[model samples]
Target chain A: MHDDLYLALRQCIIDGDPEQAIELCQRALAAGIAALDAINEGLVPGLNHVGEQFAQGEMFLPDLVMAGEAMKAATAILEPAMQKAGARRETLGKVVLGTVQGDIHEIGKTLVGTMLSASGFEVHDLGVDVPFETFAVKARELNADVVGVSALLTTTMTGQKNVVEALERHGLRPRVKIVVGGAPVTRSWGEEIGADGYGEDALAAVALAKTLLGK
Target chain B: MQPKLEILERELIERILGEAFTLIAEPGVKVQAPAAVELLAGAGARIEEGVAHIPEALARRALASAPREFFLHNRAGEAVVRYGGDAVQFDPGSSCVHILDPATLEHRMTQAADLVRLVQVAEMLPQYAAQSTAVVCNDVPKETGDLYRLFLVLLHSSKPIVTGAFAAHSVPVMIELLAADSGGREALRRKPRAVFDVCPSPPLHWSEFAGQNLADLARAGVPAEVVSVPLAGAAAPVTLAGTLVQHAAECISGIVIHQLAQPGAPVVWGGAPAIFDMRSGITAMGAVETAMLNVACAQVGKHLGLPTHGYLTGSDAKVMDAQAGMESGVAALMGALGGINMISGAGMLDSLACHSAEKLVLDAETIAMAQRVLQGIRPRGESLALAMFAQAGLRGEFLKLAETRKLFRSEQHLPSSVIDRGSLHAWEQSGAKDTFARARERVAELLAAYRRPALAAEVEGELKAIVGEQARRAGMEQLPGLGT
Candidate 1:
């Protein structure tokens, strides 16, 4: 019965049925399934799979956003039991992320922000065309362990170096590991610019942030 | 093959080139590099010493005669790097000297072995055309940046190289080094093993170094790909239309130089430009808009009736993490969809700063899917009728059809382990590994099974000796494990 409920919850999430997830959580609760069990065995696992499929392009971003909402709803329902059991989700690390100025491209930034959030990083996404100072300001405000900046041009890729230089001028360098990414960034580049980390893609970004945060 | 961009159909392409030619003739390119201007003048371009006034008729005539498509012959398969062919081929660029390892989360120095392994894997993938020359081995010297990457990639694979030199001084030497493996330098010139990239500064200009490189590479008969980088909102016109015009102008001018250097010489109109980041002021490689602009400009190249190349396959989504997968996948998908010829920048990570073997494998799987997507559907005569459908029956399942079993595998793409096909329970059984973890294992397996290409003993000796000579010239006591 536990296995069946778990599978059903997973399918519901994969199918992107938020209402069904909430309904199933209620049903599982009535069936005497522990709220913690509902979350651990049902919600988180389902969403993780959802993220995997979405990443693989077996599904798309709509599926991911819906599954995120479903996971949130399930987590909310299981909150009391989770708190009672002292179940704490370990945040990998806090990341202050944003797209650099002049370019308004946001999908990649939004996708990273979403994945990082789901991966348990506290992401402070200072939306599109973020000003350079905002990064230092937000990193300080959030006490962020990593600052991830995104640019998408040969001209704009220089902005990543500028952000690191700005951080250095403000004495924010080394205090917070700054990572830069976009279509044009390279690791040698990260080293050339003295950045703490560089991710070729978004998932690696999250993992790098975790490492920087010492998770 | 994806359908041609409607607005950029053959007639329109001819028309675009016509307009581009007019722009070039009326306002010849401003050659910022005197050496380049001299070369162009010497080669036949109408130049009054420093200024090159490219005639529109010459630009169009040269491109009109140039082939619209070409093929890179590799053992795996003939990858059609089509300006207009079966599909666009994407090769990740060469030589990022550092990588942020996802496993360690720390930035580590990159090595030449990393590049060799990457080229081997990139060779296996259907997406890449000629493994890139940018493999940097940290164990080797770093004076030439990624020349070591190119050397090892040559040693490891026979794939054509989509590479560029970081320093102008090394371009000829590197090309000479590449020739050591095949026939003498002259014979190597015939087959054209590598495509040297030349970029014009956007807003209609060319750097002294880049311009000279273009002229010299053209003189060498090595295929030259003129890269016009117009960063929208930065070095380029902010509007997309403006950017395309600037791109056309640059390519037209470069084409005139290339043709005049040696009329009928091969050249690919290419670029890796993206919009500038207004915030920190950098070129962002991960923006969808950048990738989109890349495709649109490729349309301009097609308009010029020339084969187009764009280094649009890498993304700065940073890590090989989810962000990397999505951003890389999107660019790969669009690039294939747009039918770009010879798309470079594969396997790049950290926005383009790093290259990962694992991500190379994963991107290959993504390319396979994207290639399938670009294939659209093949409606052969056998597939045109309801007769086969009748055999499957009404309200029916394909699982029960004998024909379904026969054709399913061929019709559908069976993705590598990079794609998780396991159900929840099966996935749980497999230790619930993430995509990155699975990709890592797959990378290990592919590398383990890799067989190095065979070279004639003399060729092998020569290739090794070149590296040895280079090492010696650089004052190395001995060359690393490159066998003589």
Candidate 2:
């Protein structure tokens, strides 16, 4: 019976049915299954399968985003229960992401946040046209392990360097890794701005985040 | 007699425009400039927190006043590029940061010398009707880079330029540079030698600088080409029709602002729309869907009887290979058949980040082929080849006939040596060069054959003084040598 419940929970997430996934999580918790077990044995495996299918070309961005939504919904339901039982879920790292000032381009930065969240990194997306002070404030507040800056236009790309300076002003450099990305952000530009890494796209961003954290 | 292509039917275009009008009035467009907001508000648009809900009637009034066509003139005062109807012209893609290195096949930061070389190559090719301020000069300070590029194009080529300004303040300075070349501001306005491209941020938002540029160009009587870039599935709706509605909304709002600033100002409905690649998270400029969007967008523009422009003939490949050829060639033909007035993006690669001089030469050949295709099938004589068949008879010796010799040149497009046609043995005997290799050699020959057009001594001195003064303001003591 427990095995059947777990299978149903995993299938719901794979199907991208957020409401069904949440119901399954609630049912599992009421039936004496551990909250951590529901997340580990059900939600994580479903997200992992979606990732694998995405890599193999069997799925697309909308599919991946839907599955991420399901995972997030199911996890949210189980989080309070896990906290009541003194449980903690393992995460890769905490990342603060945003598009820099003077650029209101949102899609590229949003994609990075979604991919990082789906990959088990705790993401704090500050949204578009973010001020430099907000980035520094969020990094200090969240105790972020990594901060990713995105700028789509060449005119706004210099804002990435200003972001680096903002983080340094708050004395968050050296300990926190900075990864810059967007259509115009290049490896050399990242290095020139004193960023630790640069990602060509969202996938490269996830991989670079892992390497930065030594995962 | 031109072979035309249409992507959107008449009914569909009406429906799209209807939706676009509703969008601007309901969700409204975000206007960052206070003056633009005031202009729209004074014109009866509801202003609620910097967003203008423009009514369809206001947009129609603006459209009615907008000029249907405009001409870009050369230094000799000849109207060379027409931005109306089915007249198609091409220029290299503008403002790329990198130039593809011929020796290493790598992309390097483009400098002033690189921009000069690109202008010279474009000046010699009759296939390119106008020159573009094609590449960014990394050698200059960022503040003055826009004017520096225009200065180089004016010195090297007498062709009318397709260019843009990055900052709002630079618009007037760039215009001043053009005026100095054409004798004065009034003369430059009478025969406009350049068109400035001003783009709106996607999903119905115009940045402050972009809004200022539209007004500045309108008041100055210079042409402003609105390049609306809607990245499908990212900044815009994923479906092609949905994106078209968004494009129309953005462009109509721009026209309203431009015409309000100056009634009867000229504007071109231009775009660089692309599909956002889901797998790679990149804007796929080379995709067939992107071409479809451009063709459909221009059809909507033509529906309103306005001048149109598009970005095509670009490749996503990092190198000059078969993928580059297929992508660039297919889109060039599509843009031509769709009757885009001014097609930009030849010599662009890596999703429009890099420019290649060799690729520029090769694209000229592709442009030549597209122009030939535009001249649809026509009967040369009264018999439509029947008389020629009567002369040849069963002997099949049309090669010996005088009519054949007289008509073949007009009938066929004789491509340059860049396109290989000789036998395999002959190709192998002459170093077995591929298209890229042949293109590199062609670049050298064209550069060697290039002679700079002479300008009036007084006008030339004035041009230098304007550029030099701007350079000093940006902390540069001297302008980079043009190697003239």
Model 2 quality (TM-score): 0.97
Q: Candidate 1 DockQ category?
A: incorrect
Model 2 misplaced regions, further than 4 Å = B389-391
Please estimate how well model 2 matches the true structure, expressed as its whole-model Cα lDDT: 0.91
Model 1 ranges off by over 4 Å: A1-215, B4-28, B32-35, B42-51, B75-86, B135-143, B380-385, B394-397, B480-484
Residue pairs whose backbone atoms clash in candidate 2: none
TM-scores for candidates 1 onward, in order: 0.66, 0.97
Q: What is candidate 2's lDDT per residue for B1-484, written digit by digit as tens?
A: 8999898999999999999999999999999977788789899999998889999999999989999999999999889999999999999999998999988998988889999999999998999999999988888888999999999999998998999998989999999999888778898888999999999999899789999999999988889999999999988999999999999999999999999999998899999988988887778989999999999999999999999999999999998899999999999999999999999999999997999999999899999999999988898888986788899988989999899899888888999889999999999999999999999999999999999899888888888898888888899977884677
